[model samples]
Target: MSSSQQSKLIRVVQIIIDVIFGGLVFASGFLILWIIFTPLILKTSDISITASIPVAIGANDHPQLPVEVVGATGKGIRAAFVSDAQGTLQLETTTWSYIIISNIAKLLTALMLAYIFYLLRTVLRSIRAGSPFAPENAVRIRRLGYLVLLVSFLRPTVEYFAANEILNQLTITSPSILLPSPFKVEMILISLLILIVAQVWSYGLELERDQELTI
Candidate 1:
């Protein structure tokens, strides 16, 4: 393709990506707000916890707990246990109020990702304008790389604590422990690569400035 055609194509693709990121940011922000204010908007009594925990059982024994019951303490207890010859157990819960704070951290990570995309879109704009090695573009790229690194470090810590908090609130006996190496190796590598590229771009910008001065 011709240079102009390539630039146009890149611009179109960047625009599409920008729109998608914008939509994601808006959706995440809306969810965060909804989660935060829903309890306040509705009556406390109206808010209820509905959980589903899957239990594996031996074929020889009947489940000790009934599917649904009201305890003597006046609280509703709902449980389901299925017999699995393979002996596998899975537990799932949908307690929005209890997990809202965790969701906020996750949503904030999404917002940070959206911001990275926004920075990338700005760099694309500079590239389309035939100034790919502009000093500002290099700075923007560095910022993007830093944000990615920050999220990589923060996300796992937040999630680990959140999972523990959820388990604690649900009165679960099992412990939720996250590994020490929570950040993905691939993400760390990618962030390092981006930072390297940003440095290279900065060097190219310096050369361009020197050339302009020499001319």
Candidate 2:
């Protein structure tokens, strides 16, 4: 094949790879938001929990709780809200709130991952062309890598607290001011997986950028 033809083929391949990678990242963000909102949607049923039921009728027993909502939007929006509830945990409380926050973080993280993947594909094309330094792209990729790392570091703190608090309450293993830990672990695991994927994509971009810069 002619050199020009070969370079064109390589660029086409890069574009294909980028499309697939970008799709995955986009789906990741959507999935994270779904995870966050699942509880709220399911909890549409009024959730009642007796912190302490009185044996006698007319016993002044009430369960007051603070609940928050967490989640992401299709267009890179993150949202959260709080409600004061009586006798039942609001849909806003429990893992839903944390899910919203986690998904929001995940949405941003997903964008970083997608951008990194794009950078990698570009660098691959540059490599094939024997024109090493794609300096502007490299710089941007590096910045995105750093941002991904920062987001990853923040995720554990955000994911774990909600999961741990709810799990401990449900399991009755700890007096944490949370409840109904049933789905906490699942939610957290999903978030962790997303974080890992985002970080890997980010680092991969960073490496590609470094290689291009060096060449």
Candidate 3:
């Protein structure tokens, strides 16, 4: 395709992504508000918190045995191992305020991601305007990469404590189970790629300045 055609196509695609990310940010905000206020408005005594846990059935003395028994006894003895002997634990809380507070890390991570997308949209706008090597764009790209790296590390820590709190709420006597690693190799790689692209943009900016001086 011609350069003009490609530019137009890219502009159209960027606009589409911008709109989608904007919508997602709006929805996330709404959900966060709902989570904060729902219990208060509805005067509900308990909010349900759900999480996955590994369960083994061979021994009745398993750490999750009490939870499993409580969950399954409601159905029948035969139905106890319905989830292939592993299942999710659901805890009800009269104190949802604390639960919401504990989950703020996840919400913050989501907000940061949305902000990154917003920055990306701005960069795309600059590109479409034929000024892709703007200094601010490089800074924004670098910031986006750093934020992704930060969230990647923060997620596991937040989830570990949150899961422990949930288990505590359930009154389960078992020790906190080791959660799976939340580190995503792909995310780290993508962050590094973005930082590299920012440096490339910096080099392009220098070249552009040199050409302008020559002209």
Q: lDDT of candidate 3?
A: 0.66
State candidate 3's TM-score: 0.71
lDDT of 3 by residue, 1-215 (tens): 99999898988989887887887698679769867775685475444543243223322333332333444455445644332243334434455654564556557767877887888888888888888888888888888888877777776557656655555555444543433344568888888888898888888889988888995
Per-residue CA lDDT of candidate 2, range 40-97, in tens? 6658856532122111111123123334465635565566544323222222344454
RMSD of each: 11.4, 16.5, 7.6
What are the lDDT figures for the candidates, one per model?
0.65, 0.52, 0.66
Is 1 or 2 the stronger prediction by lDDT? 1
How well does each candidate superpose onto the true structure, as a TM-score?
0.70, 0.40, 0.71
The candidate maximizing TM-score is 3
Evaluate model 1: give its lDDT. 0.65
How many residue pairs collide in each prediction?
0, 2, 0
